[model samples]
Target: MNLAMRRSPWATLTVLALAQFIVVLDVTIVNVALPHIQSGLGFTTDGLQWVISAYILLFGGFLLLGGRVADLLGSRRVFITGLALFGVSSLAGGLATSPVQLIAARAVQGFGGALLSPAALGILTITFEHGRRRNIAMGVWGGLAGLGGTAGVVLGGVLVDSLSWRWVFIVNVPIVIALVIATPVFVRPIAPHQGNRSFDLLGAVLGTGGLLAVVYGVVRAEPVGWSSAEVIGFLATGVVMLAAFLAVEARTTAPLVPLRLLRARALSTAGGALALNGAAFLSMFFLTAIFLQQVRGDSALRTGVEFLPMGGAAILGAVMATPLVTRLGTRPVMMVGAVLNVAGLLLLARVDAHGSYPTGLMPGLIIFGAGLSAIAVPAQIAAVVDVSHQEAGAASGVVQAFQQVGGALGLAIVSTLSTSRTTSAIASGASQSDGLTDGFHRGLLVAAVYAVVTIAVTFLSPRLAPSPEQIAEAAAVAA
Candidate 1:
């Protein structure tokens, strides 16, 4: 490739970052708009969860498959297609007048997201050279991840309050259209590698169906009764299908997720931790947002502002953890993160109705942010450590797949548990809505317990760090 023929690095970053930012930003944006969406669309409690779940389900389900498509079909083509689909879907969602339409559009957006996100990462790693520049780029990438979650809440709150929630989806149309125009000119294309890599259709069906079943079962555990036949049947079906997927992957020549990747102790363990940690982490954002809005009756912007301190603390913690990860090794750093996360979750149980924002929420938010900062960097590092530079996109895609799936699962489960307990408490003849607060507290406590379990699992992980040789090799390959 001629140097002059290539696009500016800044242009590349702009498109890639915008792609990631939009994908991540929507997660929080929806959180902010949930009440509005529910009211506007006549959504039931179950439908509200679908608002988030629909996107994640497709995003996670199609992610590995999407990565494969980029590899086989060419990243730029796939990316442009993704961009077009996403823009159209957003328009559909923005214009949606009924619950079914909005849910369907969100699902389409997830499919587009699955295509765009991995291709964006592939473009970034390939476009930029390696070494310190790569680290800085990855930092930017990670920072955006950090900011996306935090920014979403803050910005989403402001957007929804000042503008209609429809503006949320409508806003993306212009940005994506602009980015799409720039992509072909600026975004580098992969030379088409000739091969007949088959799509694992059976694997996809089994894997996706299994995951959906497990998610449904977990979500319905509290609401439908843990012992109910429906929950058990779904859980069993999900497990069986997933197991079948694993078996098929091992036997197939081309697999969506190569079982070989799971051989690396650090990468596998880190991926699992990332997923579990996401489950715990998303719970806080969802629960706290509802608390501020529904229980405390705070305005959206106020809710956003109240959380500013947590974002800063989270940044501080993440920066602090990066250096510590170098010195202490990835597994140990993660163990510490898991511990902090549990501590935060435990403390969050103390929040009450009409509670002080700083006094009630700050402690948990700060600690949680610190925990994310510590673990997320190391986990990301571990995931890509052995990935061939050319395959960085695939690695990034897998990590994201785990995250979206974790978010969907966590949101479903936590919502179910809290809502079930709250509804039961209310129906059991509680004097007031204040009685529902108990369910939120209990949910937090359970989440804390889950955090502790994650920490304990961290002990089983390898206490390995990147050797100097591996670092040098990685740098050379990335270059």
Candidate 2:
């Protein structure tokens, strides 16, 4: 073991968690700055969404491959490489003078994120033994993961308002420099997976292509009619490619995702629940940002400040989850979270054009933020706890992939619905503000429905009962 690993494992966790935070932060930091970016680069409205989509598509599509690579190579090597790439890409993005340049840089940043996230997670799983210690670490990890995107909104506003939108990307340079300097001193290397299993090149190609096509189709379905030949062709191609990917996985000796991993009821169900949670959670952010700025006429800075409470609430929920999971187990705690999520979304559906933040928005944001933290922490723990060390990266990657894909698909669906409703209301002579508010409420209602389904799924899914050995470990930790 390295001197750092021998002296303090907590140091290693901190470094890993910080890296994860930066990766997740980039996902939403650019959202609030989109208008600025578009105006600066003279981008068409349709082309602007690609600034976000490019990152998500590549991040989601390559995660499994990235995870397996982390396992085949050492985690430390992959993590550092990813950090360097991310730093370079962020610099490129900050210097970008054109729409294409910025979008390309963002896509590369996403690729680096895919490499960093799973490897950091795999290192965490191996560094901390399973039980209370691991649970606590996961709670912290989950809290940071949950906070990153929401906090990004607030940070983006501050940066854009005080400085320029370019500062949002430039700010990462200093942080990345700090992390790189500290990494060798604080984090230790882990052994790679043994045996000579070749990387699944064919599986990676099929899976990446299929996911890209599907996400593209979903994103474009709103601008172009769903019945458009482009939408149908992309969707059909995606499905066929995914089926082929699965076939390849079944036959390959070392698949990108092991088929046996899907048989674990706890992991599989948690992944599904996480996907649904992602759909609702991300939609909440997207719609609320629009409602605050467009309907309520709040400035970007004010919108960011308004979101501060949600971030605090999420951190608190993560802190509380550790003991709750210890006392009640993962399934029950997750079900409670689902109930809170449904209630919060239902309340949010009451937002109107002439509403105030406290009565109309704060209540739902607080409740939903708490619920999101609860679900995210436990779902993350359950997804990897049952898996072997060698498969940890793949498991983490799968859970995160579901989240990215869910967010993309959910945003597309809700945005399409909101646009259609707003257009219809305007056609009927409603004012623009009221029409937009109406559409936002309708979208919130759909999000509430998704939360309700999440509750049902949590109830019906098999419980993640700890094994006897795990129970003993927990008891010892308590003592």
Candidate 3:
């Protein structure tokens, strides 16, 4: 037996989950600190965006490459390497003196996250045997990840208020250090697949480049307008590059992403459904955050605290989903979750211009948050249902990439629509609060539509996943 086989599996899982938590946390922790970062770094109003955009661009762009690399190399090696890079970059970002320096650090941090997140998932899937145990593991993984985003805002608020904005980045250092030290002790060494290990240089370049351009364009659309020349140019280029990448993948003998993976019905279906779930879920958070601060007149700290109930609901839903999935299967549970998401969005859409949080927000936030978790846990499980142990990293990367792209694209579209509605309302005779409320309603409605679409896509998933015996047989054949 290897070193890992001797260690406790749950301990191994705890290490992986903590690493992924920090990765997810960084995605939103910076949001609460943006204003402080601007003043500290002397960033221009427009240039301040690069602090966040730099991270999103790199993290979203390099996920596929990171996953494939983990598969080509070894999961434990790649996971540890990612932790070191992420920790070092976080330290650099915390100590930066200039906007340029900070932005550069954030970019590197994002790249590290790209490498770490999927590899962590790959290790988890490999460590746990698929079935009830894996389902429970995924539930914990999915729940913590969902909670991390919500926690980021809350923790960022406390750090920025109590200490300085730099603490947001600095806080990750100790946790990462602990994880790096523990990983090798608890995690097993999964050897790389033995064969021709020729890397797909062309596919990696085109795929990463294409995703970067697309994410950059999507993020830029809100500030610059989708019609802006810069937005149009980047988006057009991204489409062309992505098309070329697909063509290259189809022809390459050793493709970065083997095209055959798409033929796995469960993987494809779950990826699509999760993309839409990401769209609605992220947009809901964005819209609700603004509504609380701008319309409800809550402080940033208070706003973060207010979201706690919803975050708790998400955890509960995640815990509830594991047993339900083991009994009912993935498709039915996914459909129910998607429908609940739509119901929640509609409730949020009806928020009054002047109303209490309990009456106007709690109901919707609780339902939406729970629904989001329900979808996430199952979709994560399904994404790897038919995938072999060797490709777990790549499969995890694909699922993460889909969600990242969806969140970016959905946020852009929903925010644009909301802003236009608010502008129009203000142009007429509406009060500022009323106009903001109208805009939020419009955005929430759009998010509701996205959830509805997710319900439709969930239907494509098989009613039942392969039995544990069948999964083992398949893995053996593939190996």
Largest TM-score belongs to which candidate?
A: 1
Model 2 CA deviation exceeding 4 Å by range: 1-14, 42-49, 97-99, 123-147, 181-194, 384-393, 465-479
Structure candidate 2, residue pairs in collision: none
Q: For residues 140-201, write the lDDT of model 2, one tens digit per residue.
A: 77557667866798898899889998988998888888888887778787889897658797
lDDT of each: 0.76, 0.78, 0.79
Distance from true position, residue 105, model 1, in Å? 1.8
Q: How accurate locally is residue 40 in candidate 1, as Cα lDDT from 0 to 100?
A: 83
What does the lDDT read for residue 466 in candidate 1?
Answer: 80
Per-residue lDDT of model 1, residues 214-333, tens digit only: 987877777668899999999999999999999998998888777877777766776777777877777777777666777777877777777777778778876676567667877888
Tell me model 1's lDDT, rounded to 2 decimals.
Answer: 0.76
Q: How well is each residue in 295-409 modelled by candidate 3, as lDDT tens digits?
A: 7777667777888878888878877875677778778888889988999999988888577789878898899888987897778777776677667656766776777767656
- Identify the candidate with maximal lDDT: 3
Enumerate residue pairs that collide in model 3. none
- Quickly count the clashes in candidate 3: 0
Q: Is candidate 1 or candidate 2 better by lDDT?
A: 2
In what order do the candidates fall by lDDT, top score first?
3, 2, 1
